[model samples]
Target: MKDKTVAIVGGSSGIGLGVAKQVVAAGGRVFIGGRDAQRLERALAQLGPAADGHSVDSADDASVAAFFAAAPAIDHLFTPGASYALGRFMELDEATARSPMDHKFWGQYRVVRHALPKLDAQGSVVLMAGALGARVGLTGAAYAACNCAIEGLGRALARELAPRRFNTVSPGTIDSELWRERPAALREAAFESFAQGAPLGRVGTVEEVVDAVLFLMGNRFMTGSTLYVDGGYVT
Candidate 1:
């Protein structure tokens, strides 16, 4: 990772931030971007001198465009940004079901379009989708639809992008701040229940997923592949 420049959009926290830390630790420079300036600041603070931050709204073209325009030459791009509408399929509204495409798929499109010209010749791109997309899950129709599309998009880009690699990481329930939205007890119980179904018998970690992201970026031979870092949940 030495001397490599990695850009992580929506990287202020969670798996994205995990990757940033490792990159910097390995003597690479990381530019962390996100919608919240304060969060990016906090993230950069934790990352120390090898890190920088930019405010970016991945869903908006102008914000994404301007954000990338200012980036130093980047060798890898990772965006773990996603929004979901959760409910029964029949009960979901049109906007809720379709929002993932606009925000996740097209959001990635906007970032890639802006970053392509500036990326290193051997650069890599890692996009995130949920484990729900790779398998069936109740009350996640909208989320599943969006990630399923992302899986396809990553494969398509692998071919279109040529020597540059593009991959998707579909993570199962990871132990991250994302669970903070739920009451602590409920979140723990939910994870405990979900973990039992996986062969690993545990939820994943940001460190584990981050390792996969780094692997995808570092391996030039890997392209257009969907790596499930889901603790065997997909199995």
Candidate 2:
């Protein structure tokens, strides 16, 4: 990974931030983008000189365009940033039901579209998916569809883009900052439920998922594949 510059959207925190840290540790440079300016500042401080960042909202076309415009040529791109509401289809209003497709699915779509021109010819793109994409559950209909769309987009792009590889990483329940806002009791209960469902018998860690992302980024022969880092949960 030495000297490679990776551009990560939604990298201010959670899995995105974890990937940034690892990229820097491996002697690569990172250009991270996120909506939260303060959090982006903090992340850049933590990552030191090897990392830089821009304020970007993946949901906005102009913001995403400018974010990439300011960045130098990149060897790889990782988009782990997306925001959406999840609920049963009938319970959601039209806009609500479509939020995941708008934000999570189309958001990454915008990012990748803007990135291709600047991406290295041999560069790789890794999109984020989740266990829900493969294993459906109640109240996650829109979310699951969004993930499936992303995986399909990745595969299609792999074929269309040729040498510029594309892949998706679908992770199961991970004990990451995404859950930090939840009440302790609620968080623990959800974790317990997820643990019982997965063969690993516990939630995953950010490092574990990040490892898979790094592998996908480094493996030139891997493209059009959806790698599950879900601890057998998808099986």
Candidate 3:
């Protein structure tokens, strides 16, 4: 992976940052994009000197296009962040629910569409969805719908990209900042609930999801596959 260029959209935090760190550890040069400059800088700092930072708004086509234009020939591309808004079906507002479709679903779509031309022949694209794509539980309709769409997109792109390799990583209940945003009591309760429900008896870690991404990026033979890092959540 030494000297290989990897471009990651939404790499400022969470799973994206995890993957960026792993890529750098594997001897790859990384360019990470996010809307927050400070967060991006901090991520780059943690990733060491081999990582570069860029400001990108995944919802904006112009921003995505320009970021990709400045990126070097990418050996691998990964998008681990996506917009999320949760609410019951009846409580879900049309605009709010569809917002994730624009950011998470279409955002990933745009990244691949624009980055494809810049990818090396053997390059791979690893997209992040979640267990909601295949499993049904407490998540709202928007999350489930968008994730399912992401999975379908990966399959189609895998066939279209052919030898280039396109795949999706579906994680379940990862302990990311998203969960940290909640109140301590609520967070603890949520974690405990997940621990009891998940077949693995624990939530996933950022490194676990990162390992799956690395596996997909390094393996040339795997494509059009939805690799579940969910720890039996779907079972």
Top TM-score model: 2
Descending-TM-score candidate ranking = 2, 3, 1
- Whole-model lDDT, candidate 2? 0.92
Q: What shift in Å separates residue 84 of candidate 2 from its native position after superposition?
A: 0.8
Task: For model 1, give the 10-residue run with minimal summed lDDT.
Answer: 80-89
TM-score (all chains, Cα) for each model = 0.95, 0.97, 0.95
Candidate 3 lDDT over 71-152, as tens digits, reads: 8889999997566677778887899878778889999999888898889988999998888768756646788888888889
User: Least accurate stretch of 10 residues (summed lDDT) in model 2?
Assistant: 226-235
Q: For candidate 1, write residues 1-235 as lDDT tens digits.
A: 9999999998898888999999999999998898888888899999999998789998889998888888999999998865555778888788887777788878988888998988887899998987888765776777788888888989999998888889999888899877877689978986887787788899988999999999999988999998888877743
Q: Residue 189 lDDT in model 3?
A: 82
Q: For model 2, what is the error of residue 56's alpha carbon versus the real structure, in angstroms, after optimal superposition?
A: 0.2
Off by over 4 Å in 3: none
Query: Candidate 2 or 3, higher lDDT?
Result: 2
Winning candidate number (lDDT): 2
| lDDT (Cα, tens digit) per residue for candidate 2, span 1-235 | 8999999998889999999999999999999999999999999999999998899999999999999999989999999998888788789898988998999889999999999898999999999988888977677888998899999999999999989999999998898988877789978987887788788889899999999999999998999999888878742
